[model samples]
Target: MVIAIGFEGSANKLGIGIIKDGEVLSNCRTTYITPPGAGFLPKETALHHRENVLAVLKDAINESKIDVKDIDVVCYTKGPGMGAPLATVAVVARTVAQLWNKPLLGVNHCIGHIEMGRIITGAKNPTILYVSGGNTQVIAFCRKRYRIVGETIDIAVGNCLDRFARILKLSNAPSPGYNIEQLAKKGKKCVTLPYCVKGMDVSFSGILTYMEERAATLLKEGYTEEDLCFSLQEHVFAMLVETSERALAHCNSTEMMIVGGVGCNERLQEMMEIMCQERGATLFATDERYCIDNGLMIAHAGAEMYKSGIRMKWEDCTILQRYRTDAVEATWRKD
Candidate 1:
């Protein structure tokens, strides 16, 4: 019967969600979109969250039809995100917790995604591929920790896609990645792009640099935007699939789950599904509702931690920008 409210403003999105026990009652969010050829800045994104967070919170509570006094805890993402935006959300969460006299819990952003994925997809002990604007990693639950077996050496795959989208001047209305996915569907050819995968880790900076340097030349030489987008996706996703397969083998796991913003890409999901089928494994994934960053994830993860006797004091609720996925102990899960 525990009720919890979670706040998430890790990057461009400001989300507020309410959950009762393990059931999500309301999930509300607003995004801070930048214009084409531009990425969200910390200051601007923080401003957006500050302006919209209250409205989103109000909507979440209203939609849930729950009284504020019934909430048992307040949760927020504390790390592995843009500093200003994370801090902005943390401030709001702390204020709300104090005002409501509820327990406060700080959650890791990556763990939030993983926990949410597990709850929504009902995947147990699966090797996870976590790809987002800020992170890229292949993880498995081992010894009460989300152990990272593979990761990006440089920029995340989503960042690579978003930067390339800027070079192509793609719209950021829904997202740069979504626009690229649409354009790639029309591509009939796969242009060769650098595929850099060193053992278990993948690198995207070299490929991004190569594309940036030769984009105009390639276009003039008869390659369309669709071709370039398709090629980029194929190479990067192949790298991801390769590393994920290795992680699955390393962990001796028969189930695979994809979580994070990039997990919403259909092509990536299809490729992973093929790989899972070949490996005799099950693939678990959620749509944009759980795949993209949202407050529900924070609330769910925080509630799990709280149920496991984890709590954060007022003085200990500090925001971190580089919190690793493996840093948090998954105390809530026995496996």
Candidate 2:
């Protein structure tokens, strides 16, 4: 039984997980809520990571009912995340790997999300709707790697939600998107917002700006804020659902795994699931434990790579803020 400890520090949350043979022992998260008016400032994120990494790590290990010594390998997210958060987690992974004389696996942040969705839902070869603060993509597996079938040309779905949440003065604490979803329940969708999906790719920056302007106008015009919030969620999420359906149709695959922070929205999942049902495809959606960023996915990716005898040279291992999901060189799969 290979026991592994996973560290997810690629972004705002510190996700730690204990797993063996794809079976999760424990998964926990410590969310880093940014200060007001500060949207994921790199220095603040790094500082927060440095302060909480140890506590989160120890708690995860303790809660797993497994000894730290039993961990056969240490897994850490490599990139496609904030540089400071990734570096902070990398140092912890490096230390743990060194101390135990165990192998260290550097996992891709996006792959972690994808893999975790697969593990949670038991969906094999499912297409993916991966949207987050940094990424927006419609992906499918092919050629031993997930291929991007479509994506955003600009900002991600989650970023748009958060930006709108701030525009409405919703809490940036805990989870902004989740908060936005809550406020959306009270919204009446009064104003019409732009929805742009071009050839499998979507753009939100323009719509976001348009909505902001609309909201400002409505507010000055004595319209209720709830009406604006309602309109925003409906339009934004409708765009997401439409894009996902388009991807599902374009790929001709019904199996979709929605992975990322935005996946937590019940509305998004509901629409996607309905689309799949209509198309006779399966849609896999993981819970917060796996859906949100976490370390276990990274560890699992690392273990798979290591078992296949793939190892990255120390000199070549560096943090990447931008990595194409399909750009994975190789998985070290022996098959």
Candidate 3:
């Protein structure tokens, strides 16, 4: 029985979570939202995290009804994110660990998403489709790590969507991607767009470039924004589904899991469900609670590693901007 507190501020969102054993007790977060046609800057995102993390942590603790002293371990995302935001969370985590006299665990942001997906959906040994603003990969447990079977060659899916939203000056209230998903629902026309998939990998930069040109031309030509949104989602999601199917075929696995910010798209899920149905396989997914970046995942994954005796000192909490998913040794999974 272990109680753990986890902090996550790897990107635009700042989150705090508490976990007891393998179950999530509370998850609280605040996203740093930029205005339309804008993207979040590292420094600004870091400042947002610094301002809101403590309050989020307090809320998490209060919601969980757990004393700070009862927490056995402190965990925070250590890598594969913006340096400023990562450092912001690390400082808070280290400070809390020292103040509470608890051991510290540094967790990989990508692994946090994967582990939380597995725990919430109970999909063992499934092929992973990790699509986010910074990352896009198809992963599976190989030997002692999550091996990347397929991935993006350029920008990620979520990055493409965000940039497109900026081009159209779309609102960033909830999220650019979510807004696009809603616009896509009102589309009936399917305009042609580039779908680039090389081997088992996918690329979104070319698609984004083409979509930008089309968006400008079509908007001038009295084409609806909804049509462009629909076309973009259809083509890109098809590419992703195709790549995932190929990975599943190569691995001969009957289960597939999607984890990341873009995983919240209903069209992506619908396309993936069709793919799974055709292959007679099961699809596993969680709602945005576990799909999007959150401290709950950090807590759950770090707690697992900590229970396995993994610990890190304050001096060793270095953060990486491009930590690969396959780099970490998967100590928790036997397969």
Query: Mind giving the per-residue lDDT tens digits that candidate 1 earns over 1-335?
Result: 67888899999989999889889899999999999999999999999999998899999999999999998889999999999999999999998988898999999999999999999999989999999998999999989999998999999999999999999999998999999999999998888889999999999999999999999999999999999999999999999999999999988899999999999999999999999999999999999998999999999999989898997778889898999999999999987
Which candidate, 2 or 3, would have the higher TM-score against the true structure? 3
State which candidate, 1 or 2, has the greater TM-score. 1
**Model 1 clashing-pair count:** 0
| Error in Å for residue 205 of model 3 | 0.6
Higher-lDDT candidate of 1 and 3: 1
Indicate which candidate wins on lDDT.
Answer: 1
Misplaced by over 4 Å in model 2 are: 329-335
How does each model score on lDDT? Answer: 0.94, 0.79, 0.91
Candidate 3 lDDT, 100-183, residue by residue in tens: 999998899999999999999999899999998889999988898999999999998999999999988999989999999999
Best by the TM-score measure: 1
Better of 2 and 3 by lDDT: 3
lDDT score at residue 10, model 3, on the 0-100 scale: 91
TM-score of candidate 2 to 2 decimals: 0.93
TM-score of 1: 0.99
